[model samples]
Target: MKKIKITILFLALLQTFSAVAQSSKIKNLENQREQIKKEIIEINNLLSSNKKEKNLTFRDLEILAAKINIKERLIKINNDQINLLNADIKSNEIKSEELKLENENVRKDYASMIFNSYKSRLKESRIMFLLSSSTFLEAFKRSQYFSQFSDDRKKYSNKILKNLTSLDSINKILKDKIVNKEDLIKSNNAEKRDLSNERNNKNNALSSLKRKENAYKRQINQKQRQADLLDKEIDKLIKEAIRLSNENKKSSTFSLTPEAKALAESFTKNKGNLPWPVERGAIIQKFGLQPHPVVRTTKIKSNGIVIATTKDANVRSVFEGVVLSILKFKGSNLTVLIKHGNYISAYKNLSKVFVEKGDNIDALQIIGEAYTNINDNKTTLQFSIFNNTTPLDPYLWIAK
Candidate 1:
């Protein structure tokens, strides 16, 4: 009986641990779902409602594509949640069965114990039991036996109550989980419907883009040329800054002062924890090379990530730094570079600038307004990070 009780306790602990683990995973997936949903809303806000599919431009197509992609991911998260709930339900059902079996065995043992105790009670009164003992030690042993029997009965009674309570709790959990699973299924179905509509919209936009394939190709080429020019200029400026900093030094990197070295070390330690350039936005384009969403055969190269935000959103510094330079050229609105020791962060496509060269800036200080294209009515900020002259992916540096 003791061994059986120990076994049941072990199983109960194991089940508790499993439930906690499963709950943690479900919570993590829920967090991811909420973040994706928020991003979809931000992207939708950036999209121009006035533009019909027939008038959709390349940037419009990209926004729609991004929204659709995120919606699919939300649906996938819902599916994962449903799968986990199903597993939980199954586990609970199995555990409930085991508890029921254990309870029955315990009740039987308890019933037998009560019946035997009743027979013994009828056979002798407590006074008669003690008087009938052959000696003092025998009488003491009999008293102990009676006390132990009573304690055992009480222990078994408590065990029965605990088992019943456990069964009730498991049943409640099962019922709640079933309801949750049903709700998730309904939610997934609704998301699927929305996803279907988004796909249709994207397809219509793609059709419009395909109709003017050659014209759009020229437009893409022109945009790429501008982007390439801006990248080259930024690279040249970074190199010049490095050369001036290392004028008398033998090393190729910046010669930092004690204070600057400490700041650099702090920045390095926060590689993945830096704030976003804009307070509210979603990344529409990532760094590096990738194929165009509409034009699969054509490749697009990006030196930095592009964040689509509301019109005239404030662009802020991700970390404390000094204003390195402000740049402007045709097709590329305005670019501001902030230097943090050997690392530099660049903010491009701004309609205004609030800081100047040699100006000391604090983390999250408003630098300028993100450029809003009047023609497309879309606002976007181009943000880049570089370790001296080498470009780093801003996505890796920014906080998720």
Candidate 2:
């Protein structure tokens, strides 16, 4: 009985841990799904609305591809949840069988105990047995035995009832798990269908893009030139900034004053604590080299990340800085360069500017609103961070 109870307790604990683990994983996957969903929603709400907003550009195709990929991943997670449920149900079924068998054995043992006790009492009544004692000491011993026998019978009956109760509880839990498992399967199938539909949508978008291959290539070239021009201008401005910083000190490096050094150190320490340039947007184009979304063989180099945001959305500084320059080039939106000690953060593609050169700005201060390209039907901000003229990956510096 002790071993059987220990086994049941161990199984119960194991089941609890297994269930908790599966629940945690499922919860984590659900959270990831929600985040992706939010990103999709933001993209759709902020972009892809105008008549020119068909799936004709890389950004549009990228969004569709991302949506399909996320849905597929969501389906995979649902399947994983269903698999875990199936596994748990099967394991519990085995445990339930073992418990039922043990309960039956306990019932039999309890009946045998009762029968033996009855037989002993019938053969020699308790009073008669006490009276049959040869002496006082013998009577005393027989009386103690009678009491112990009664207590043992009560204990045996209680143990049998407890085992039966446990068995019933296990059976109920198993039934519940089975029902839950069925529900998970249904949800899994639904997600799979959703995934299939997403894939179909992706195919349709890709087909639309494929139809305009030549025109799309020319558009890509034009956009690439624009990006290259932006990069060059930003680079030139940063070099000029570095030169200016070093001019007074007659050195190639920035001469940090006491306050400047402290601020620089603080900014360095908060590498992953900086806020985003826009409050709500998705990083459509990440920093560094990326393959074209439709033309896989074509490569594009980016000095910064492009955030697609709502039209006229305010662009804010990620950190405290002094405005160094506001660059305006033909065929490009306004760009603001702000310096924080030896570091510089650049906000580009603005329809309006609120800050001027030499303005001291606080963290998350709105410098300008993002530019909305009327012809392209796009609204986005290009953000860059530099450590003294050296480009740093913006993602490493921004909060997730």
Candidate 3:
């Protein structure tokens, strides 16, 4: 019986810890859902206010598609949360039932012990028991037996009280978990409804944009050329940096400066913990091949990374490095490339520049302010990282 009570107590504590962990995960999911909702609202406002033939460029369509995708992801997360909460609630209910049964057994044992002890302690019973002894030795043995019986009774009573306290605590914890589950269910339902509305809005916006293909194609071509030119300039700078790095080698082995080496080490150490370059943003284009959202038959490839953010957000350095080049595009924006040991990080589409060629930059240092499209009020930064011209997926490096 003692072993059984101890086992029950241990299981109860474990269940309490599991509940806490689940609650934390639910809170994090809720926060992310809220952010997605805000982005959807921003997109809706942009779609409704503009009446100038809808420009309806490829970039505009891409932004709307990304918003819709985020909304869908949010809905899935909500459903998952609901399912998990329901499971937890059921588990807690089962645990509560077990606790109740254990408590009842403890109470019954305690009551039985109390009744037996009372019967043994009666005045008539005690006198009869003493007189029944045949000799002095027998009487002495009888006294010892009474003493042992009294001690056993007291111990049993104490054990029952302790079990009762534990049962009370477990019951309270289970009750709280039940309430939490109900709250989570309500929240999930609300988020699901909001996501459905956003999806509908996105469908409407996509339909309107699909009607203006000629103007959209022109815009896409111009943007593609701009992107290509930026890519070439970045490649040239990377080759130059690599050559300089090689020339400065000692004895046939390449060596980076102490500062550059330290930056590289720090950046590597924060592989999965580095923050995004933009302060407030979402990833519009992922790192690999994806079907074009608007052109169902077409596929789009992203070499580096594309982050969509609020207007005028400053692009910051991910780690300490030296500025390699600041290339001016044909339009109004500039692109800054920084070199950290053999690694390269590029920040493009900046209307204003704070860092220049040959300037030393520290981690999280501001390189430039990102440009916002006046027509759509959309701000984005094209960020990329390379290892001697070999592009790496920035998504894998940034913190989730």
Candidate 4:
């Protein structure tokens, strides 16, 4: 009876642990799904709206491709979640069977013990055994044995009660799990529907855009030239800033100042942990080479990053650095660049600039407010990182 009780207890603990693990996994998957849904909505809005001015140009196709790649990853995650649920359901079913078996064994043991106790009491068997002892020592020993037997019987009774309680709990859990499993199935079916719709939209959009291949190619070339020109101007400004910074360091060598050096080292060490330039925004465009989002056949390349945010959002520095340049480009908006050692970060599409060239700024310091498009009221900041003349993806450096 003791061994049976121990087994039941162990099974109960195992089932509890399993349930908690499954619950945690489900929660994590739900969070990931929400984030993916948000990104997909943003993409859909971009496609449907007349925000083309703030939209990804042919040169920004690489960013759009990365966004699509993220969607693919989300789909794979959903599949994995469904597989996990299936496995959990199977495991729970096996555990429920084991619990039922243990409960039956407990009931049988309890009934047998109660019957044996009743039979012994009716026959006066325990008292007779003690009375028939040949000596005082023998009688005492017999009494002790009987006392132990009664204690054992009581312990068995308690165990039976506990087993019943555990059985009730386990049964409830099983019922609840069935409901949860059904909900998971429904969620997966809904996700599949959304996935299908998104895929169909992507296909239709690609087909429609391909009809203007020549015009799309021309637009791509023009956008590429604009990006190249911006790249050149940014590179030149960064070099000049670096030269000036070095000169200042040389002039201040007598003071043995190490603050700038330490800050620079700190910035380098946190390569992939840098904060976003804007307080709250999403990456509407990514870095690297990829096919255009709208002009399907044409590939768009980007030298930097494009982050979309709420209207009138403030742009801030990811790290402490000196203000390199604040330029008004094409009479549109302001662009602020900051230099940290050999690396330079640019923040563009600002309506107002707070820091001037040569001004020192700290990490997360608001440098300027981003400009909002008059039509859709969507604010976007064009961010870029450069090591000398080579452009690097700001996304890789920023914290997710």
Each candidate: how many clashes?
0, 0, 0, 1
Say which candidate scores most in lDDT: 1
- Give the range where candidate 4 is weakest over 10 consecutive residues by summed lDDT: 248-257
Which structure is stronger by lDDT: 1 or 2? 1
Looking at model 1, report the run of 10 residues with the lowest lDDT sum.
48-57
Q: Arrange candidates, best TM-score first.
A: 1, 3, 4, 2
Off by over 4 Å in 4: 1-24, 40-75, 135-141, 170-174, 202-211, 221-281, 295-304, 310-313, 318-334, 338-345, 349-352, 358-365, 371-379, 384-400
Please give the lDDT score at residue 59 for candidate 2.
59
Residue 110 lDDT in model 2? Answer: 76
After superposition, candidate 2 runs with Cα above 4 Å error: 1-19, 43-48, 51-58, 128-202, 205-211, 218-290, 300-306, 316-348, 353-367, 382-400
Which digits, one per residue and each the tens of the lDDT, describe model 1 over residues 279-398? 888877778998876676889999889888877899999999999999997788999999999899999999999999999999999999999888777888999999888889998988
Candidate 2's C-alpha lDDT?
A: 0.78
Model 2 agreement with the true structure over 103-154: per-residue lDDT tens digits? 6877787788788878887898778888998999999998898788788778
- The local lDDT score (0 to 100) that residue 143 gets in candidate 2 is 84
Better of 2 and 3 by TM-score: 3
Q: Is candidate 1 or candidate 4 better by TM-score?
A: 1
Rate residue 182 of model 1 by lDDT.
Answer: 97
Question: How far out, in Å, is residue 57 in model 4?
Answer: 9.8
Residue-by-residue lDDT tens digits, candidate 3, 52-93: 444655566676677777777777777777776677767766
Predicted structure with the largest TM-score when compared to the true one: 1
lDDT of 4 by residue, 1-400 (tens): 9999999999989978977897798888878778666766665554444335554333223334435655776767767676776777677567667767776876787788778878878978777878889999999998887788788778767776776777677567667757766775676677667667666655654555556567877866776677667667777676565556566553321121377667667777988889888876667666888766555566767777777666688899999988878877553468888877667788877898999888989999999998886744566888988765578888778864
